[model samples]
Target: MIPDPSAPAPTVRRKPLLAVLLAPLFMALIAVSVINVALTAIGEGLGADSSGLQWVLSGYALAFGVLLVPAGRIGDATGRRRMLIIGIGIFTLGSLLSGLAPNVEVLNISRILQGVGSGLLNPQSVGLIQQHFRGQARARAFAALATTVAVATAVGPVIGGLLIQLLGPELGWRWMFLMNVPIGIAAIIGAFKLIPDDRVRTRTRPDLDPVGAGLLTLAILGIMLPFLERGASVLVWLSLPAGLIVLGLWWAWEQRYKRAGRPPMVDTAIFSQQAFRNGIVIISVYFLGATSIWIIVPLFLQMHLGHTALEASLMGLPSSIAAAFSSQLGGRHVLRLGRKMVIVGFGIAFVGLLCTTILAGFVDAGWVAFWWLAVPLTLMGLSQGLTISPNQTLTLNSVDPRFGGVAGGILQLGQRTGAAVGTAMIPGIIFSLTEGGHSWLEAFTIAMVIIMALTLVAMGVAFADRARETSAPGAL
Candidate 1:
């Protein structure tokens, strides 16, 4: 039910009150990008080696990705608002535990708990937007969501660096986790008071789809472990293929469940839309390249150039500022141009990565020309801000209201899975190049080449397809 482009936008009755519902999602989004800047500090403080450090980073996405679909189903069938509150509670507890963690292993576990909480709260954000808004107003709300996410991604490094500087490396990272406490408390209170109970508005008693949940969890765990767990081992190599097999089984099982008239973890029918499917593909592929910058750029600045966390992060400010501006202003094209904005977004990001590859390949590590980086970083932020929100707008436009939570969960699953894969695989490539006695600059450059290659391939996929324009409504 997408409105005609010429139609006037619908009105949101209580738009100002949305900040409360957006708070937890906003904080969680920031946490995803912020942790990358903390990696060097965390490894040194915990005495973690390369593999251990990778786990410290990827483990959160591991748990977060694995639980998303199940959480979406739970939110859909049960109560989205209640789940959002419970998720805030869980995330707050996880943050406290992470701050207090004495060992890397404990830190990883705490992150998993935080991931679970994040997964639970995330889908509700989408569901609530659908519940309260319609037509053009809904599109604007989604854009606003995108703007918030872009802001998080942009400033994540700065926030992480500031915390690390203020608290000192060994202790600053802990405060990063701890800072979520007060924010989560406020978000919880706001959610309780401001977000209406959409669950009670609907009579559909959504039974928890446990079997589907189990299968999806197992499938994601199998896929992720091989990447997260390093070393050339038989089990590590085998897990990916085995995970693929589990996914095939999961799909088959889901189809059967749908036929049997039971609540399925995913509505298999939703995948039929070319726009939605392609949007997911674009999201995952784009993030694989884009998210890598947050992790690897910081590593390059700190390790290769001998910059402190704060000094290194300052280099990223141009990108963050660009992203914030684009999310609010540049993203307006989605309503007029539809999915074409995504194509333009990809084009800019592709160029940004190309610039990055060339710089990492040719630029001297000790060169004081740090300002050269500002150009590509700004491009990257602009690309992300333009790409993320519009792609989301197109993807959800066609989904049925009843599956909004599930679709939202799948959206996170795609992005996090991309982040987790890129974080795991790309860094491994960089480490391997260094392990072979290559200079740090040479190693990082080689990794950048690979990322650029993949982005090109993703663009080819997008060029062949055009997304349709549509609008979806709320079920509860």
Candidate 2:
């Protein structure tokens, strides 16, 4: 039953609706970071070992990454608000289960369910933004989301530390998950009041490609399983080749399915556009460098520099503040400057990384490290501010708005994949450098080398943005 074309479009008050929609997205970001601080506490409480701890993180990420595309499609077909409410409900329930979990296995299971909730809601936020806003207003909405995510990340450890200190591990860890309860409730209530109910009506049944979903899930698991199990057993090696084969088969199957007039797990056509393709590469590389800092700096400060969690979190303040402000600015300039923002941002970030390497090498005292690290971190934040929001704007703007849900899913998948790889690789780099009785300086140097290499790649892609702009309409 098609809706009447003559019916008037529903009036949606943009600001209030956006605020309501973004609330859940903000809560989701908080959930991710809050757990990072509570990981050790949760592991100890559940009697989990190193592998179990890794599972607690990777399991959620893996589930979240794999399901994002399908969830986005579901929101597009139905109503985004409906999916948001359901997803938030599931997420809140999962958080409760996680807080009450009696064992490592239960906690891990709960984390995966929470990830499912995240996957469902993540794309809906993007879809709703695309549906409701256009041009500058849309850019602002995305910028706000990015800033919220950055701030939440920066505050996570501090909040976790204070909670753990004040309440102790058992109760404190629960608060991390429990914090979502009220936030989620507020989001649900606001969503009902603010979000419009004007969904695209359809009589034809939308075919969900379960086989493709299963294959994609298997492919991601195959790739991620080895990293999660590294240093554990010989089985890790065996999983690698099998995962590669499964992934190859999945890609081929998707192409075949697309030819048969079915919506495959991912839309292959999006990659055909040079701008979209280049945007993905730049995003992956930029995230690789940025995520490495988060993964390595915290561990380095806590283990070698002898700083507490709170202190380390405080040290990250410079970058967080810079990034939040820069993102808004970047959104404003992206339409005018085109891809110049990417080049400028990466250039600044590269210099900051160099300064950071020097500071880490020369500084011995904790206070000295803090002050010196702040300079580079602030640079990084500025660079991030310039790059991320514009990149998102470019990537989304390059695509047809009809495919916004899928595009957002793919973009987010790149981010998670980059983060997982960056997080996994940094520890390996540190471990490898320290093998020959080398000083911490050697490890820091190697990490900086990797970051610089990623920066150069991002710079190269940014330069190529000119060709992409010419080839595509509205690419800037």
Candidate 3:
């Protein structure tokens, strides 16, 4: 039977609703995370050098980041479920293409398709939660999402490594991509079955800003491409400046779009909301730290500690599990403590980071003594669990549901931007600092210090954002 078009939006049962909405997101995370572990196999198989391998990763990130706002905006206008199904289909096809790609170059193109699909689908997860749930239910929904993503991030490497070890690199990597086909199909089926039809009646006519969207997309490319490029070249230096220029033009066009009563890619007015601005600062900085450890630690483990991919992945598992638990606890208590939860979450995470950094930097612990790292990582995960859901809840809570898609898109944009920057710069710092007879320990230590600092800044920002205290902490 068809979902009743006239029924209220949140008519579906909550758990099933979340399961359907979050499945694609879970697969997207797995898709990217798994690739990192499989990159070596891919490189050797395709005869790819460093640059080709880098593109395999960067291509997906660039496309995914660039298209997020446009995808979200389109979803908000046309219908989120409609857009999501299309995205899932594209993602599945991308996986098929990736698995089939005989060469590295074709693999890069397939990665872009996967990224685009992710970009299209991710915002809907957040927006739909905002759209369907209210008050305490909303917080719980976000918490569930946070934990699911954390677990997915944590498990991706281990699962990928085992697949490679058991199946052989050539075939294992291909199976990783092929794995998504079944998951994506199931998610599509569940989406049709569980997700309710849009029924809020949009606040305004659906006037999409194609010009603004194009400008925004190009602007992202301008900024992101430079980071993705390696080597010191004139073009490398020019990428950031060129991207900035495009952004300025996009802003100018946005003003015109607003005045003309068209939907700008992101309404400039969203920035005016104090909670939104504060949340942006908090999440972006947090990601700078959060994403860095994930990338750098595995490299450290596999190379410096001389551990296999599976070993490194196992070392990280406790943290993900901790984070999953903490996320639920944070959500359960958010209504009780309100903004203090965010503060406490960051504080806990800060301590965790400090411990992890000291242990890694000073002790120079290796794979044999994995518990030393595991202790701090678990703490860090818990901190993230506490921080992400509450902060996300507070951020989107303030914005009206009409712009929910845009708000979620921008929030995710900030995260992707931070992750991209961390992945590009921090690893480079490790390599650069480690060169010229510097020890890996010293290089990693310095990176850890920098990584710790980002989280510290985020903690400060979260503490400073007192506006959430005054608002309904659990506003419907």
Best by lDDT: 3
Model 2: how far residue 317 lies from native, Å: 1.6
TM-score per candidate: 0.89, 0.93, 0.93
Residue 143: error of model 2 in Å?
0.9
Q: What is the lDDT for 275 in model 1?
A: 72
Off by over 4 Å in 2: 1-10, 198-200, 230-234, 365-369, 470-474
Candidate 2 lDDT over residue span 339-426, tens digit each: 8877899899999988888788666444464556787878988888788888888778777766677788878877877777777777
lDDT of 3 by residue, 39-82 (tens): 88999888999998988888899989998888878777767888
Q: Give the alpha-carbon lDDT of every model.
A: 0.76, 0.78, 0.83
Residue 17 shift from truth in candidate 3, angstroms:
1.5
Clashing pairs in 1: 2-471
lDDT-better candidate, 1 vs 2: 2
